[model samples]
Target: MVEIEKRNSILEVGAGGGYLLNHAMQRKKKNAQYIATDLTEAMIKVMCQRSNLEALKIFYAGINLFLLMKLKIL
Candidate 1:
């Protein structure tokens, strides 16, 4: 397990059902900023509803991998 000394901004692309997102929230780092997004809308809905997840910040969006050469998230 990697210890997070400084909870920097995070962006999770292609986050499926947010299983990892739930785990990330458990850390509860004060400076943590989280963003979880998926390619499927249905999956995102289920994750938000069924998971009952809590985080500092969560973002949902569809990404086209072909168009994305490199992503710089801040």
Candidate 2:
């Protein structure tokens, strides 16, 4: 588990490839949330595959507003 003094929620907009998002998730283990958004189904699939199940609350959406409205992209 990572122990960072200052932890903040991460809102990644247009997380197309998901590589950066995946890395960010791995870096911070506690009190950190990740929200990934993409405009294509194929991209979302790739993103899901990159994410680990152990993550706390990793959210995925087709657009930023989907997450903002508290709804799934699909």
Candidate 3:
């Protein structure tokens, strides 16, 4: 079996909607802190509203650092 620490932290950048973080909270070990950061306050607000987990931390910063993502779409 895979052993895990009692405390954990997951930081998701450009975490729009926070779907992955939401699922991670359910599957990961206890005492894990989920931090979701997005490029806009709108996205973060929406994510916080959609999320039922009280431990989730939502933060926003206006930065687009996804060069690879833009290239992929182009």
Please give the CA lDDT of all the candidate structures: 0.53, 0.49, 0.49
Over the stretch 37-58, how does candidate 2's per-residue lDDT look in tens digits?
A: 6555466556665553221233
lDDT of 1 by residue, 1-74 (tens): 55543466556677776677656666636556666766566666666665654323334374332111111222
Highest lDDT among the candidates is held by which one? 1
Error of 1 at 38 (Å): 0.9
For model 2, state the Cα shift of residue 13 in Å: 0.7
Can you tell me which runs of candidate 1 are displaced by over 4 Å?
1-5, 53-74
Give the TM-score of each candidate: 0.57, 0.55, 0.56
Q: Give the poorly placed runs of model 3, Cα more than 4 Å off.
A: 1-7, 53-74
Cα-lDDT of candidate 2: 0.49
**Regions of candidate 2 where Cα sits further than 4 Å from its true position:** 1-5, 52-74
26 Cα displacement, candidate 2 (Å) = 1.9
- Candidate 2 clash pair list: none
